[model samples]
Target: MQLKPALGAIVAVSMLAIVFWQQTHLDPKAPDAEFTTLSGEQIVLRELGGQPVLITFWATDCRACIEEIPDLIALHQQFAHKGLQIIAVAMPYDIPSRVKQLSEMRKLPYTVALDIEGVHARAFGDVSLTPSSFLIDRERNVVSRVTGRFNLADWRARIAAM
Candidate 1:
């Protein structure tokens, strides 16, 4: 009957609305951890709550990660002046020297940290995939976590809104 089809369509629309609401409103606190930069500088995750922060887990050997550097740099350049903090953390298996060398060679304009003992990796939800990115709001709540390559335009909009 027509009533049955209308009920099914309503149910589907309700489900979609719930999913969209969750994506836009659900926020979780980021894990607190200490990040050690290549220069031996220490950055505490929780300490950076007044500004939006972008944390990316990458490896020197990951081609996808390597390819995403320029995008990350562009993001940094676009928002760094707007109270955005960007940190790139190398995976546990990536050598510290290589991370430093690549950062220097690329002239990366953001903080580059080393997860030599996998502490950072474990803290950030045991992130094992390359190019994992998390966006934290100024209140220290994690707004989004993308496992692979994410849409650059979407990222720009999210950061710009923050």
Candidate 2:
């Protein structure tokens, strides 16, 4: 009985340590990070400087991410001329070929990049979850972040406010 309690305590302590470590290292707002395009070209976050950007972290296999693609495309078309740049950063789990196939199937019209090293996701914080999005303003400041599904109306309102 005593041994069981000791083992349980050890597990609890280990879990706590992991939580603390993740929380301490995660950055909610740090915009300047290097990104690579699906075409094997490199770009920096500042490349979108002086423009409102919507950076979406996604994966090809994620159902929610796939479902949101249409909405995202609509948003891109609706606001592209209004200084809104939608950047879809595909997670490294999905290769360039897969990304291109998916984009072609979905008819995605915005700028899409490949996070082959997942460095961009880490710079913004670990985004293992699909359909995670960050809205960054012209100054490279993260204005808002959304996990899971997001509504078009909410995004429209936020962009209008900016």
Best by lDDT: 1
- Candidate 2: tens digits of C-alpha lDDT, residues 21-117: 6446556555587776666666677877888889899999999998898889888888899889888999878878999898887778887898887
lDDT of 1 at 85: 90
lDDT of 2: 0.80
My TM-score estimates for the predictions, one after another, are 0.82, 0.79
Candidate 1 wrong stretches, greater than 4 Å: 1-27
Residue pairs clashing, model 2: none
Q: Candidate 1, overall lDDT? A: 0.87
lDDT per residue as tens, model 1, 7-39: 999988986665455445444888887899988
What is the RMSD of candidate 2? 5.0
